[model samples]
Target: MGGDPVTHGGGAWRAKWWTQGEEPGTTGQWGVWESLGACDGGGGDGGDEEPPAGGFVVSEAQFNQFFPNRNPFYTYSGLVAALDSFPAFATTGSETVQRREAAAFLANVSHETGGLVHIVEQNTANYPHYCDTSQPYGCPAGHDQYYGRGPIQLSWNFNYKAAGDSLGIDLLHNPSLVQNDPAVAWRTALWYWNTQSGPGTMTGHAAMVNGVGFGESIRSINGAIECDGGNPAQVQSRVDKYRNFTGQLGVDPGGNLYC
Candidate 1:
Protein backbone atom coordinates (compact mmCIF):
# COMPACT_ATOMS: atom_id res chain seq x y z
CA MET A 1 0.00 0.00 0.00
CA GLY A 2 2.89 2.39 0.59
CA GLY A 3 4.71 2.25 -2.71
CA ASP A 4 3.99 -0.57 -5.16
CA PRO A 5 6.29 -3.55 -4.78
CA VAL A 6 6.37 -4.14 -8.55
CA THR A 7 8.22 -0.88 -9.13
CA HIS A 8 10.75 -2.21 -6.67
CA GLY A 9 12.16 -4.11 -9.62
CA GLY A 10 11.35 -1.64 -12.40
CA GLY A 11 14.43 0.40 -11.59
CA ALA A 12 16.69 -2.16 -13.18
CA TRP A 13 15.21 -1.47 -16.59
CA ARG A 14 15.89 2.24 -16.25
CA ALA A 15 19.62 1.97 -15.70
CA LYS A 16 20.62 2.91 -19.23
CA TRP A 17 18.72 4.73 -21.94
CA TRP A 18 17.80 1.80 -24.19
CA THR A 19 18.56 3.39 -27.53
CA GLN A 20 17.27 1.39 -30.46
CA GLY A 21 19.66 0.38 -33.26
CA GLU A 22 22.64 0.65 -30.94
CA GLU A 23 25.12 -2.16 -30.93
CA PRO A 24 28.09 -3.80 -29.10
CA GLY A 25 25.83 -4.14 -26.02
CA THR A 26 26.90 -3.24 -22.48
CA THR A 27 28.92 -5.03 -19.83
CA GLY A 28 27.46 -7.60 -17.41
CA GLN A 29 24.22 -7.48 -19.36
CA TRP A 30 21.39 -9.59 -17.95
CA GLY A 31 20.65 -10.58 -21.53
CA VAL A 32 17.35 -11.54 -23.15
CA TRP A 33 15.79 -15.00 -22.57
CA GLU A 34 15.97 -17.68 -25.21
CA SER A 35 13.49 -20.42 -24.24
CA LEU A 36 14.40 -23.85 -25.54
CA GLY A 37 10.84 -24.74 -24.54
CA ALA A 38 12.18 -26.14 -21.27
CA CYS A 39 12.10 -24.80 -17.73
CA ASP A 40 15.71 -24.58 -16.58
CA GLY A 41 14.55 -24.93 -12.93
CA GLY A 42 16.43 -21.75 -12.02
CA GLY A 43 13.50 -19.86 -10.56
CA GLY A 44 11.30 -22.38 -8.72
CA ASP A 45 7.64 -22.90 -9.61
CA GLY A 46 5.66 -20.55 -7.32
CA GLY A 47 2.05 -21.74 -7.75
CA ASP A 48 1.58 -22.75 -4.08
CA GLU A 49 3.77 -20.15 -2.45
CA GLU A 50 2.31 -17.19 -0.54
CA PRO A 51 3.16 -13.57 -1.38
CA PRO A 52 5.67 -11.87 0.87
CA ALA A 53 3.80 -10.74 3.97
CA GLY A 54 5.92 -7.66 4.58
CA GLY A 55 6.09 -5.19 1.72
CA PHE A 56 9.17 -3.25 0.70
CA VAL A 57 9.59 0.36 1.74
CA VAL A 58 10.38 3.30 -0.58
CA SER A 59 10.72 7.05 -0.11
CA GLU A 60 8.49 9.41 -2.10
CA ALA A 61 11.46 10.71 -4.07
CA GLN A 62 12.61 7.20 -4.83
CA PHE A 63 9.18 6.03 -5.97
CA ASN A 64 8.75 9.05 -8.19
CA GLN A 65 12.20 8.55 -9.63
CA PHE A 66 11.27 5.07 -10.81
CA PHE A 67 7.75 5.92 -12.00
CA PRO A 68 8.54 9.53 -12.81
CA ASN A 69 5.66 11.68 -14.17
CA ARG A 70 3.31 8.71 -14.04
CA ASN A 71 -0.22 8.42 -12.68
CA PRO A 72 -1.63 5.68 -10.47
CA PHE A 73 -3.78 3.86 -12.99
CA TYR A 74 -4.04 0.29 -11.61
CA THR A 75 -2.21 0.51 -8.22
CA TYR A 76 -2.85 -2.47 -5.92
CA SER A 77 -4.86 -4.41 -8.48
CA GLY A 78 -1.93 -4.35 -10.86
CA LEU A 79 0.34 -5.73 -8.16
CA VAL A 80 -2.19 -8.38 -7.23
CA ALA A 81 -2.68 -9.38 -10.85
CA ALA A 82 1.05 -9.58 -11.40
CA LEU A 83 1.52 -11.80 -8.37
CA ASP A 84 -1.54 -13.95 -8.94
CA SER A 85 -0.83 -14.72 -12.57
CA PHE A 86 2.84 -15.51 -12.11
CA PRO A 87 3.05 -16.97 -8.62
CA ALA A 88 6.58 -18.11 -9.26
CA PHE A 89 7.68 -14.49 -9.74
CA ALA A 90 6.05 -13.40 -6.48
CA THR A 91 8.58 -15.11 -4.22
CA THR A 92 10.42 -11.92 -3.28
CA GLY A 93 9.44 -12.07 0.41
CA SER A 94 13.16 -11.79 1.06
CA GLU A 95 15.81 -9.66 -0.54
CA THR A 96 17.18 -12.47 -2.69
CA VAL A 97 13.89 -13.31 -4.30
CA GLN A 98 12.99 -9.71 -4.92
CA ARG A 99 16.30 -8.95 -6.58
CA ARG A 100 16.22 -11.95 -8.90
CA GLU A 101 12.67 -11.64 -10.16
CA ALA A 102 12.89 -7.88 -10.40
CA ALA A 103 16.04 -8.20 -12.43
CA ALA A 104 14.43 -10.75 -14.73
CA PHE A 105 11.22 -8.77 -15.35
CA LEU A 106 12.93 -5.42 -15.98
CA ALA A 107 15.47 -7.05 -18.24
CA ASN A 108 12.73 -8.62 -20.30
CA VAL A 109 10.88 -5.32 -20.81
CA SER A 110 14.03 -3.54 -21.89
CA HIS A 111 14.71 -6.13 -24.56
CA GLU A 112 11.15 -5.96 -25.89
CA THR A 113 10.90 -2.19 -26.31
CA GLY A 114 14.49 -1.28 -27.07
CA GLY A 115 14.43 0.16 -23.52
CA LEU A 116 12.20 3.05 -24.58
CA VAL A 117 8.43 3.35 -24.41
CA HIS A 118 7.49 2.31 -27.97
CA ILE A 119 5.03 4.07 -30.24
CA VAL A 120 2.06 2.10 -31.54
CA GLU A 121 3.42 0.85 -34.85
CA GLN A 122 0.87 -1.53 -36.33
CA ASN A 123 -2.53 -0.27 -35.22
CA THR A 124 -5.53 1.61 -36.60
CA ALA A 125 -3.84 4.94 -35.85
CA ASN A 126 -0.16 4.32 -36.57
CA TYR A 127 -0.48 1.51 -39.08
CA PRO A 128 1.16 2.30 -42.42
CA HIS A 129 4.42 3.42 -40.90
CA TYR A 130 5.04 -0.04 -39.50
CA CYS A 131 2.44 -2.08 -41.37
CA ASP A 132 1.24 -2.81 -44.89
CA THR A 133 -1.64 -0.53 -45.95
CA SER A 134 -3.31 -3.17 -48.13
CA GLN A 135 -4.28 -5.17 -45.07
CA PRO A 136 -7.23 -4.31 -42.84
CA TYR A 137 -6.34 -1.42 -40.49
CA GLY A 138 -2.85 -1.97 -41.81
CA CYS A 139 -1.95 1.66 -42.19
CA PRO A 140 -2.93 4.38 -39.84
CA ALA A 141 -0.85 7.41 -38.90
CA GLY A 142 0.56 8.81 -35.64
CA HIS A 143 1.73 6.97 -32.52
CA ASP A 144 -1.78 6.24 -31.34
CA GLN A 145 -2.85 4.72 -28.05
CA TYR A 146 -2.01 1.06 -27.35
CA TYR A 147 1.50 1.80 -28.50
CA GLY A 148 3.28 -0.25 -25.89
CA ARG A 149 0.71 0.86 -23.32
CA GLY A 150 1.17 -1.63 -20.51
CA PRO A 151 4.35 -2.70 -18.68
CA ILE A 152 5.12 -5.06 -21.55
CA GLN A 153 3.67 -2.42 -23.91
CA LEU A 154 0.87 -4.37 -25.66
CA SER A 155 0.62 -3.23 -29.27
CA TRP A 156 -1.33 -3.96 -32.51
CA ASN A 157 -5.12 -3.57 -33.00
CA PHE A 158 -5.99 -7.23 -32.41
CA ASN A 159 -3.87 -7.38 -29.26
CA TYR A 160 -5.35 -4.16 -27.92
CA LYS A 161 -8.87 -5.34 -28.76
CA ALA A 162 -8.34 -8.77 -27.25
CA ALA A 163 -6.82 -7.32 -24.10
CA GLY A 164 -9.75 -4.93 -23.84
CA ASP A 165 -12.29 -7.75 -24.33
CA SER A 166 -10.63 -9.83 -21.60
CA LEU A 167 -10.76 -6.86 -19.24
CA GLY A 168 -14.25 -5.80 -20.33
CA ILE A 169 -13.09 -2.55 -21.90
CA ASP A 170 -13.18 -1.47 -25.57
CA LEU A 171 -9.66 -0.27 -26.29
CA LEU A 172 -10.33 -0.38 -30.03
CA HIS A 173 -12.78 2.52 -29.91
CA ASN A 174 -11.09 4.46 -27.16
CA PRO A 175 -7.52 3.29 -27.23
CA SER A 176 -6.80 6.00 -24.71
CA LEU A 177 -8.47 3.69 -22.18
CA VAL A 178 -5.08 2.12 -21.69
CA GLN A 179 -3.78 5.48 -20.53
CA ASN A 180 -7.06 6.80 -19.14
CA ASP A 181 -8.12 3.79 -17.06
CA PRO A 182 -5.42 2.61 -14.72
CA ALA A 183 -7.07 -0.75 -14.16
CA VAL A 184 -7.41 -1.38 -17.90
CA ALA A 185 -3.76 -0.61 -18.50
CA TRP A 186 -2.64 -2.81 -15.63
CA ARG A 187 -4.82 -5.70 -16.75
CA THR A 188 -3.27 -5.53 -20.21
CA ALA A 189 0.16 -5.68 -18.61
CA LEU A 190 -0.81 -8.71 -16.52
CA TRP A 191 -2.25 -10.42 -19.57
CA TYR A 192 1.07 -10.17 -21.36
CA TRP A 193 2.96 -11.25 -18.25
CA ASN A 194 0.82 -14.41 -17.89
CA THR A 195 0.90 -15.49 -21.53
CA GLN A 196 3.38 -18.20 -22.52
CA SER A 197 4.20 -19.13 -26.10
CA GLY A 198 7.42 -18.93 -28.15
CA PRO A 199 9.79 -20.11 -25.45
CA GLY A 200 7.40 -22.68 -24.00
CA THR A 201 5.15 -21.85 -21.00
CA MET A 202 7.13 -19.25 -19.08
CA THR A 203 6.48 -15.71 -17.92
CA GLY A 204 8.19 -12.87 -19.78
CA HIS A 205 10.60 -12.63 -16.85
CA ALA A 206 11.57 -16.29 -17.15
CA ALA A 207 11.89 -15.94 -20.90
CA MET A 208 14.61 -13.30 -20.48
CA VAL A 209 16.99 -14.75 -17.89
CA ASN A 210 16.22 -18.16 -19.28
CA GLY A 211 18.00 -17.08 -22.50
CA VAL A 212 15.03 -16.82 -24.84
CA GLY A 213 15.91 -14.53 -27.74
CA PHE A 214 14.49 -11.15 -26.68
CA GLY A 215 12.80 -10.38 -30.01
CA GLU A 216 11.59 -13.93 -30.51
CA SER A 217 9.92 -14.17 -27.10
CA ILE A 218 8.14 -10.86 -27.60
CA ARG A 219 7.12 -11.74 -31.15
CA SER A 220 5.42 -14.82 -29.76
CA ILE A 221 3.43 -12.64 -27.37
CA ASN A 222 2.72 -10.02 -30.05
CA GLY A 223 1.73 -12.71 -32.56
CA ALA A 224 4.30 -11.11 -34.86
CA ILE A 225 7.02 -13.60 -35.57
CA GLU A 226 8.70 -10.93 -37.67
CA CYS A 227 8.74 -8.38 -34.89
CA ASP A 228 12.42 -7.63 -34.26
CA GLY A 229 11.96 -5.21 -31.39
CA GLY A 230 13.18 -7.62 -28.73
CA ASN A 231 16.87 -6.95 -29.26
CA PRO A 232 19.24 -8.45 -26.61
CA ALA A 233 21.24 -5.27 -25.95
CA GLN A 234 18.17 -3.46 -24.74
CA VAL A 235 17.37 -6.29 -22.35
CA GLN A 236 20.82 -5.92 -20.84
CA SER A 237 20.29 -2.17 -20.39
CA ARG A 238 17.13 -2.80 -18.39
CA VAL A 239 18.99 -5.32 -16.28
CA ASP A 240 21.47 -2.57 -15.64
CA LYS A 241 18.66 -0.33 -14.42
CA TYR A 242 17.41 -3.05 -12.10
CA ARG A 243 20.84 -3.43 -10.53
CA ASN A 244 21.17 0.30 -9.99
CA PHE A 245 17.73 0.71 -8.46
CA THR A 246 18.31 -2.25 -6.14
CA GLY A 247 21.53 -0.70 -4.98
CA GLN A 248 19.83 2.65 -4.39
CA LEU A 249 17.12 0.96 -2.29
CA GLY A 250 19.74 -1.09 -0.48
CA VAL A 251 17.63 -4.24 -0.95
CA ASP A 252 18.10 -7.52 -2.73
CA PRO A 253 15.68 -6.56 -5.50
CA GLY A 254 15.52 -10.14 -6.60
CA GLY A 255 12.19 -11.85 -5.79
CA ASN A 256 8.87 -11.08 -4.04
CA LEU A 257 10.12 -10.92 -0.46
CA TYR A 258 11.37 -7.63 0.87
CA CYS A 259 15.02 -7.26 1.65
Candidate 2:
Protein backbone atom coordinates (compact mmCIF):
# COMPACT_ATOMS: atom_id res chain seq x y z
CA MET A 1 0.00 0.00 0.00
CA GLY A 2 3.02 2.25 -0.04
CA GLY A 3 4.86 2.88 -3.28
CA ASP A 4 3.54 -0.54 -4.26
CA PRO A 5 0.23 0.81 -5.46
CA VAL A 6 2.00 3.57 -7.36
CA THR A 7 -1.12 4.68 -9.22
CA HIS A 8 -2.47 5.64 -5.80
CA GLY A 9 -0.44 8.83 -6.51
CA GLY A 10 0.73 9.27 -2.94
CA GLY A 11 3.54 6.73 -3.24
CA ALA A 12 4.84 7.97 -6.60
CA TRP A 13 4.79 11.51 -5.25
CA ARG A 14 6.57 10.25 -2.15
CA ALA A 15 9.07 8.24 -4.16
CA LYS A 16 12.27 10.15 -4.92
CA TRP A 17 12.41 9.26 -8.63
CA TRP A 18 12.22 12.13 -11.09
CA THR A 19 9.75 12.12 -13.95
CA GLN A 20 11.06 12.85 -17.43
CA GLY A 21 12.29 16.44 -17.80
CA GLU A 22 11.57 16.94 -14.09
CA GLU A 23 14.19 18.38 -11.81
CA PRO A 24 15.51 16.21 -9.01
CA GLY A 25 16.14 17.26 -5.44
CA THR A 26 17.21 15.53 -2.28
CA THR A 27 14.53 13.55 -0.44
CA GLY A 28 16.82 13.48 2.65
CA GLN A 29 16.14 9.76 2.85
CA TRP A 30 18.29 9.30 -0.26
CA GLY A 31 21.78 7.88 0.19
CA VAL A 32 20.72 6.33 3.48
CA TRP A 33 21.70 2.97 2.01
CA GLU A 34 25.10 4.07 0.81
CA SER A 35 26.72 2.04 3.54
CA LEU A 36 24.17 -0.79 3.60
CA GLY A 37 26.31 -2.49 0.94
CA ALA A 38 24.48 -5.10 -1.14
CA CYS A 39 22.51 -6.79 1.66
CA ASP A 40 25.21 -9.34 2.32
CA GLY A 41 27.19 -10.02 5.51
CA GLY A 42 26.95 -12.12 8.64
CA GLY A 43 24.15 -14.52 9.43
CA GLY A 44 24.29 -16.44 12.65
CA ASP A 45 22.67 -19.79 13.24
CA GLY A 46 18.90 -19.46 13.54
CA GLY A 47 17.34 -19.55 17.05
CA ASP A 48 20.66 -18.71 18.64
CA GLU A 49 19.38 -16.33 21.27
CA GLU A 50 17.52 -17.78 24.21
CA PRO A 51 13.80 -17.15 23.96
CA PRO A 52 12.61 -14.07 25.75
CA ALA A 53 9.61 -14.27 28.01
CA GLY A 54 6.46 -15.65 26.34
CA GLY A 55 8.71 -17.52 23.94
CA PHE A 56 9.93 -16.02 20.66
CA VAL A 57 8.10 -13.27 18.87
CA VAL A 58 7.43 -15.65 15.95
CA SER A 59 7.96 -19.37 15.98
CA GLU A 60 7.64 -21.65 12.93
CA ALA A 61 4.41 -23.17 14.20
CA GLN A 62 2.94 -19.79 15.03
CA PHE A 63 4.06 -18.38 11.68
CA ASN A 64 2.28 -21.25 9.95
CA GLN A 65 -0.83 -20.41 11.93
CA PHE A 66 -0.54 -16.79 10.84
CA PHE A 67 -0.33 -17.81 7.22
CA PRO A 68 -2.90 -20.54 6.87
CA ASN A 69 -2.24 -22.25 3.53
CA ARG A 70 0.91 -20.25 3.04
CA ASN A 71 3.08 -21.19 0.10
CA PRO A 72 4.91 -24.36 1.07
CA PHE A 73 7.88 -23.17 -0.98
CA TYR A 74 8.58 -20.41 1.50
CA THR A 75 9.61 -22.64 4.37
CA TYR A 76 10.45 -21.64 7.91
CA SER A 77 14.08 -21.97 6.91
CA GLY A 78 13.58 -19.03 4.60
CA LEU A 79 12.16 -16.99 7.47
CA VAL A 80 15.21 -18.05 9.40
CA ALA A 81 17.25 -15.71 7.18
CA ALA A 82 15.82 -13.05 9.41
CA LEU A 83 17.81 -14.44 12.31
CA ASP A 84 20.18 -11.50 11.92
CA SER A 85 17.44 -9.04 10.99
CA PHE A 86 16.78 -7.79 14.53
CA PRO A 87 20.12 -5.99 14.70
CA ALA A 88 19.42 -4.24 11.42
CA PHE A 89 15.75 -3.69 12.16
CA ALA A 90 16.54 -2.34 15.61
CA THR A 91 19.85 -0.94 14.43
CA THR A 92 21.55 -1.91 17.69
CA GLY A 93 19.38 -1.39 20.75
CA SER A 94 18.62 -3.06 24.05
CA GLU A 95 17.34 -6.65 24.17
CA THR A 96 13.84 -5.54 25.08
CA VAL A 97 13.87 -2.87 22.40
CA GLN A 98 15.06 -5.42 19.89
CA ARG A 99 12.13 -7.63 20.78
CA ARG A 100 9.76 -4.72 20.30
CA GLU A 101 11.32 -3.89 16.97
CA ALA A 102 11.02 -7.47 15.78
CA ALA A 103 7.35 -7.65 16.70
CA ALA A 104 6.63 -4.38 14.97
CA PHE A 105 8.55 -5.44 11.88
CA LEU A 106 6.80 -8.81 11.54
CA ALA A 107 3.39 -7.31 12.27
CA ASN A 108 3.73 -4.76 9.51
CA VAL A 109 5.25 -7.26 7.10
CA SER A 110 2.29 -9.56 7.75
CA HIS A 111 -0.07 -6.81 6.70
CA GLU A 112 2.00 -6.05 3.62
CA THR A 113 2.22 -9.60 2.30
CA GLY A 114 -1.09 -10.81 3.72
CA GLY A 115 0.55 -12.93 6.41
CA LEU A 116 3.20 -14.02 3.89
CA VAL A 117 0.61 -15.75 1.74
CA HIS A 118 1.48 -13.43 -1.10
CA ILE A 119 5.07 -13.44 -2.23
CA VAL A 120 4.40 -10.87 -4.93
CA GLU A 121 1.83 -8.22 -5.60
CA GLN A 122 -1.73 -9.51 -5.81
CA ASN A 123 -2.92 -6.66 -7.99
CA THR A 124 -0.63 -7.15 -10.94
CA ALA A 125 -1.80 -3.98 -12.66
CA ASN A 126 0.72 -1.85 -10.79
CA TYR A 127 3.66 -3.88 -11.97
CA PRO A 128 4.43 -1.87 -15.10
CA HIS A 129 4.17 1.48 -13.38
CA TYR A 130 7.26 0.96 -11.21
CA CYS A 131 9.66 1.75 -14.00
CA ASP A 132 11.34 5.17 -14.19
CA THR A 133 13.01 5.51 -17.57
CA SER A 134 14.52 8.74 -16.39
CA GLN A 135 16.58 6.85 -13.88
CA PRO A 136 20.21 6.20 -14.82
CA TYR A 137 19.69 2.46 -14.61
CA GLY A 138 16.30 2.80 -16.31
CA CYS A 139 14.40 0.02 -14.59
CA PRO A 140 16.77 -2.66 -15.74
CA ALA A 141 14.29 -5.46 -15.35
CA GLY A 142 11.87 -3.56 -17.61
CA HIS A 143 8.83 -1.55 -16.79
CA ASP A 144 6.07 -3.36 -14.93
CA GLN A 145 8.63 -5.69 -13.49
CA TYR A 146 9.07 -3.86 -10.22
CA TYR A 147 5.69 -4.49 -8.77
CA GLY A 148 5.63 -5.20 -5.03
CA ARG A 149 7.70 -8.24 -4.12
CA GLY A 150 9.31 -9.68 -1.02
CA PRO A 151 7.95 -9.48 2.55
CA ILE A 152 7.36 -5.74 2.59
CA GLN A 153 6.30 -5.57 -1.05
CA LEU A 154 9.10 -3.27 -2.05
CA SER A 155 8.28 -1.31 -5.20
CA TRP A 156 9.82 1.38 -7.45
CA ASN A 157 12.99 1.33 -9.53
CA PHE A 158 15.12 3.41 -7.18
CA ASN A 159 13.94 1.28 -4.27
CA TYR A 160 14.92 -1.94 -6.03
CA LYS A 161 18.28 -0.45 -6.87
CA ALA A 162 18.79 0.66 -3.30
CA ALA A 163 17.70 -2.65 -1.84
CA GLY A 164 19.75 -4.57 -4.37
CA ASP A 165 22.76 -2.43 -3.65
CA SER A 166 22.29 -2.87 0.06
CA LEU A 167 21.68 -6.60 -0.08
CA GLY A 168 24.42 -7.26 -2.61
CA ILE A 169 21.92 -8.56 -5.15
CA ASP A 170 21.08 -7.17 -8.56
CA LEU A 171 17.43 -6.50 -7.94
CA LEU A 172 17.38 -3.98 -10.74
CA HIS A 173 17.99 -6.71 -13.27
CA ASN A 174 16.47 -9.70 -11.51
CA PRO A 175 13.53 -8.57 -9.47
CA SER A 176 12.27 -12.14 -9.29
CA LEU A 177 14.91 -12.94 -6.72
CA VAL A 178 12.64 -11.55 -4.07
CA GLN A 179 10.06 -14.18 -4.88
CA ASN A 180 12.54 -16.79 -6.03
CA ASP A 181 14.63 -16.80 -2.88
CA PRO A 182 12.67 -16.71 0.34
CA ALA A 183 15.58 -15.64 2.58
CA VAL A 184 16.36 -12.86 0.15
CA ALA A 185 12.71 -11.89 0.34
CA TRP A 186 12.80 -11.58 4.13
CA ARG A 187 16.11 -9.74 4.04
CA THR A 188 14.73 -7.26 1.55
CA ALA A 189 11.91 -6.58 3.97
CA LEU A 190 14.41 -5.93 6.72
CA TRP A 191 16.38 -3.74 4.36
CA TYR A 192 13.33 -1.59 3.89
CA TRP A 193 12.45 -1.60 7.59
CA ASN A 194 15.94 -0.60 8.66
CA THR A 195 16.48 1.94 5.89
CA GLN A 196 13.40 3.56 4.39
CA SER A 197 11.51 6.06 6.57
CA GLY A 198 8.67 6.31 4.02
CA PRO A 199 7.29 9.64 2.85
CA GLY A 200 7.48 12.35 5.52
CA THR A 201 7.81 9.90 8.37
CA MET A 202 10.59 8.36 10.41
CA THR A 203 11.91 4.92 9.52
CA GLY A 204 9.80 2.24 11.19
CA HIS A 205 12.93 1.25 13.06
CA ALA A 206 13.26 4.79 14.33
CA ALA A 207 9.60 4.84 15.19
CA MET A 208 10.09 1.88 17.51
CA VAL A 209 13.57 2.67 18.82
CA ASN A 210 12.82 6.32 19.56
CA GLY A 211 9.76 5.32 21.58
CA VAL A 212 7.50 7.13 19.19
CA GLY A 213 5.01 4.21 19.40
CA PHE A 214 3.25 2.07 16.79
CA GLY A 215 1.20 4.78 15.07
CA GLU A 216 4.40 6.44 13.95
CA SER A 217 5.24 3.14 12.29
CA ILE A 218 1.92 3.09 10.47
CA ARG A 219 2.64 6.63 9.42
CA SER A 220 6.06 5.50 8.39
CA ILE A 221 4.83 2.65 6.18
CA ASN A 222 1.61 4.01 4.68
CA GLY A 223 0.97 7.38 6.25
CA ALA A 224 0.40 9.25 3.01
CA ILE A 225 -2.90 7.45 2.58
CA GLU A 226 -3.51 6.06 6.07
CA CYS A 227 -2.36 8.64 8.58
CA ASP A 228 -3.90 11.58 10.43
CA GLY A 229 -6.98 12.49 8.37
CA GLY A 230 -6.39 9.48 6.16
CA ASN A 231 -7.97 6.02 6.20
CA PRO A 232 -8.62 4.80 9.72
CA ALA A 233 -9.53 1.21 8.89
CA GLN A 234 -6.20 0.52 7.28
CA VAL A 235 -4.49 2.16 10.22
CA GLN A 236 -6.50 0.00 12.62
CA SER A 237 -5.53 -3.16 10.75
CA ARG A 238 -1.85 -2.49 11.35
CA VAL A 239 -2.49 -1.53 14.96
CA ASP A 240 -4.56 -4.64 15.65
CA LYS A 241 -1.89 -6.88 14.20
CA TYR A 242 0.84 -5.07 16.11
CA ARG A 243 -1.12 -5.38 19.32
CA ASN A 244 -1.82 -9.04 18.71
CA PHE A 245 1.77 -9.88 17.90
CA THR A 246 3.10 -7.86 20.79
CA GLY A 247 0.67 -9.52 23.14
CA GLN A 248 1.79 -12.91 21.86
CA LEU A 249 5.40 -11.90 22.40
CA GLY A 250 4.59 -10.83 25.96
CA VAL A 251 5.56 -7.23 25.27
CA ASP A 252 3.25 -4.28 25.63
CA PRO A 253 2.24 -2.99 22.17
CA GLY A 254 3.16 0.53 23.32
CA GLY A 255 1.02 3.66 22.92
CA ASN A 256 -0.31 5.58 19.90
CA LEU A 257 -1.47 2.53 17.99
CA TYR A 258 -2.94 4.67 15.23
CA CYS A 259 -1.32 7.23 12.99
The models' CA-based lDDT, in order, is: 0.43, 0.67
* Per-model RMSD to reference: 15.5, 17.9
Q: Which ranges of candidate 2 are over 4 A from the true structure?
A: 1-57, 90-95
Model 1 weakest lDDT span, ten residues long: 33-42
lDDT of 2 by residue, 44-85 (tens): 322122222232345454455455666765677776665565
Question: What TM-score does prediction 2 earn?
Answer: 0.74
| Residue ranges of candidate 1 with Cα displaced over 4 Å | 1-62, 68-95, 106-146, 196-201, 208-233, 248-259
Query: Could you give candidate 1's per-residue lDDT for residues 1-259 as a string of tens digits?
Result: 1211112222222223343432211222442211111111113322112222333222233433444334354344444544544455524344544444444454444444444244222245453233223446532333343355655666656666666676677766667666555556556665666554533355554544444423333434442433344454443455466665555444543332110
lDDT of 1 at 111: 40
Question: Candidate 1 lDDT (Cα, whole model)?
Answer: 0.43
